[model samples]
Target: MGREFIDLFDKWATSYDAAVTGHDPQYRDVFENYDTILSEVVSNSEGNVLEFGVGTGNLSKKLLDADHHVIGIEPSKAMREAASAKYPDLTVLDGDFLSFPKLDIPIFTIVSTYAFHHLTDDEKGKAIKAFNEILPVNGKVVFADTVFESEETKQEIIDQAKDNGYNDLVYDLTTEYYPMKNTLQSLFKQNGFYVTFKQMNKFAWLIVAEKQ
Candidate 1:
């Protein structure tokens, strides 16, 4: 799954919150309206929630605060520990998008933020298919992450990041699993979902894919 990025996430555990809070200029735009975005994800989700990539549990806290029964799955041990430290009661499992402990309870909604890009397009398709199997009819997948309009537009953003000397950001854009709008639309539909996209920032889009 996304374990290939675990070392980076382990190293980033202490700084991840700061980075998302705009302390890192390289990622400022990517994390624009960070608080509002989390709130939007929380608002869009309902019932028992399974949150993949619960890095530092920021979004999990929001879900819990909203009185939702939430279960989080994270691959990085360090990230999982950090999230546990932040919220002792929350249960964050060791897993990724494609592989995780099977949940027994009925899950009505799945929510993730800024983390799904760890999986490639093929992996993403598999994840969506798995969601179809796990969720009830009309169940939703609410994710807010970086996505591009097209390959050309993605290249433009990467070029800008390079010009600004944000080499890490460039590397992330080039290496991570950020997908195009059409690609995601097709993935959701092929797996029996009705999807919608709302641009949340220059780099991020809110994707709501409901199981059909």
Candidate 2:
């Protein structure tokens, strides 16, 4: 399922930036909030940062502006192409998060947004383990994604979408990808990271984990 989704996204890459940029303002706000979260975690001396899913370079551009040396790994070829075109200087690699190329240099911080929830539970575990293996003892990982809200809230959101004329388009497309917050946190905890920061909002949660 994950591989199939990746392939589909690769096909959608050509229009992804336009599609997402025009998406509901809430979606864009998620990424903006991520930048705020990162500001709290990244220090002046923090070295190389790895972004697991550098989709279209939206987040990458912000990180680059922060003066961090950013390396991005993106699985979709089309997405990588889009990112390369936008930020030619970014080190974007075509690879899956589970099998990302191991860098000889130690990582300072690992970050991903929206993309991590696409992984199945087992894959999420493997991803956490991989991050642990690559990060130094005190390194941090910050991630955020849409999470499953209560049935009432979820239905309300769906109903709102229907009223907004997005029912047939966006709602159905995103329903399948919603994840549960506890489930994601457990995966990280099982892999030896401590969840230090967690903020749950309407339909998403942001988490910051530090290596113990």
Top of the candidates by TM-score: 1
RMSD of each: 0.8, 3.4
State model 1's lDDT: 0.92
Alpha carbon lDDT of residue 53, candidate 1?
91
Per-residue lDDT over 99-131 for candidate 2, one digit per residue giving the tens place of the 0 to 100 score: 777676678888776677677777778888988
| Model 1 steric clash pairs | none
| Residues forming the 10-long window of minimal summed lDDT in candidate 1 | 1-10
| Worst 10 contiguous positions by lDDT, candidate 2 | 36-45
Candidate 2's C-alpha runs over 4 A off are 19-45, 149-156, 162-177, 197-201
Best by lDDT: 1
Residue 159 in candidate 1, Cα distance off native in Å: 1.0
Give each model a TM-score.
0.98, 0.80
